[model samples]
Target: MDTQHDIALTRALAEVPGPLPVSGVIHVAVPHASRFTVVGNHLAQHAELSLTAIGIGVYIQSLPAGSQVGIKALAARFAEGETTIAAALRELETHDYLHRTRERLANGRMVTRTVFCNQPGALLRGGAVAPVTVASVPRPVVTPVVPAPVVAPEPTPVPEEGPPPVRLPSRIAPKPPRRPLPQPREPTPELHRAASALLADLRRHAPELVLSEGDVEELVPGAAAWLERGAHPDAVRHALTTELPQPPKYPAKIVRHRLTVLLPPPLPGAQELTAAPRTPVTPFQTCEGCDRAFRSPAPGHCRDCRAQYWEAA
Candidate 1:
């Protein structure tokens, strides 16, 4: 029974075909029945374009008319970052595969219009190629204009002249004046140092508040104004960092705004306020009379030793 089973297995193995060694890419073509996009070899096999650029070109070509193909949109759709996608888009534009035009609408709003060309080479060579349909939208037909026949001009008759027409100046509307920016006040050395330290420490509380050296210098005076106005360091910090925009785009701008808008009122008669009373402390002294440790104003003697000395004297 074992010999018969081994012979059957050997016969089955011989009947099966061996696996073929793959040296390169093997394509299995499947005919499309429904949704499909036809891409030309010129764009798919572009030598100058990077893989990312080629993929982006194919994607834009597959999109329907009036589709959003902006960098942010593409970045959201694909795993590529905005910078990489933006670079890819620039490559496509350079190769004439994509055209982007900024047009002002009838309502005075500006918008970007994008057009994709399937055969950019033919267009570059000045050859008329049929418009490539993207998705479902069809391209508009352009009509050629024929030149009108030229006619001879007739002689003009002289007319009685009246006063020259009054010339009117074109009406132009004056623009509105812009608001002036807040200026930083000159601060004392102590105030400046305190403000600088506070501004530098902001990043510890909120990483988004990281500031450059120039930014710290420029904003120091404003921060010093807050300190000079009797505002506590913690109060100023809270005002600058609390409820910060999800991620502060401009840390310096936010700092400047808080310093100006949330400035505390200066204390009235601040100089007249008396300092807090301190606890009385006795000085440590060694009594010469008794050679003992005591707490007294001077190192003369202890109370007990002083009484004894007076009596003995």
Candidate 2:
């Protein structure tokens, strides 16, 4: 048999007919003459042997040496479930078409070795069984890894009480400390002012939705996040307070949910974090007592009106 011709034949069969989108040697089995044998014949024609099992065996056989093969890897190749791939592997093992034997290395690591013998007596040339190739056990290489050179620390200076020490070159200085990671910048003065005004308005309009100092802290970050996304403060406030009933319960919880869930898409420069107003303010909640605009997320009267009403009482 002409071995050179066989190589040429294999290449010719695997050649792409049109433009090759990908340019890498694929580790795949082509229409080799020896691939067609009694076992392959039976597998291809027999309904008992599922096409999946045959394909699985072919894929495994096509893998290059030392390539990792797992149920997950196999399933990914065919876009099938891991369980399905595992079952197909079992079928291949049952038919003596493939198998895996484990070998533990000197480093206490166990590795699975895949062996292929699907066409038991079939070779690529004729329908002759191909010889099974078993890889020799991998001996662990214990090559000593040379560690990096250590920098000697500076020697501590001794007091003059001792006899004059032998004059030698000065010792090395200690390494400088590593710089700390940068923390997020505190909210800008403008940002703080805007956020506080929003908080006050929310509280004034929704008197039932009172916000504590701690609640304000929790709510500010979410609103800032929306602002960073380029949403106007007014939009964020409306989205947060629009659904709340007058004197709504659990103001903190309702506001947190709204801030997190109802975030608007960032406008072009909203992410730039400027203090200047990008959008005109549109008031949503107004004070019940004085009919003034609501400033905080909580339901309530404006500070001036609420204070005056208390004074009158």
Specify the highest-lDDT model's number: 1
> What Cα-based lDDT does every candidate model obtain?
0.76, 0.62
TM-score for all models, in order of appearance: 0.36, 0.27
Error of 1 at 137 (Å): 31
Model 1, 2-53: lDDT tens digits are: 9999897767655555653367643334345334666788889999999999
lDDT of 2 at 306: 83
Return the top candidate by TM-score: 1
- Compute the lDDT of residue 102 as modeled in candidate 2: 72
State the weakest 10-residue window (summed lDDT) of model 1.
145-154
Task: Please identify model 2 stretches exceeding 4 Å from their true place.
Answer: 1-39, 121-313
Per-candidate count of clashing residue pairs (backbone under 3 Å): 0, 28
Once fitted onto the true fold, the runs of candidate 1 whose alpha carbons sit more than 4 angstroms away are: 1-187, 270-313
Model 1 error, position 264 (Å): 0.7
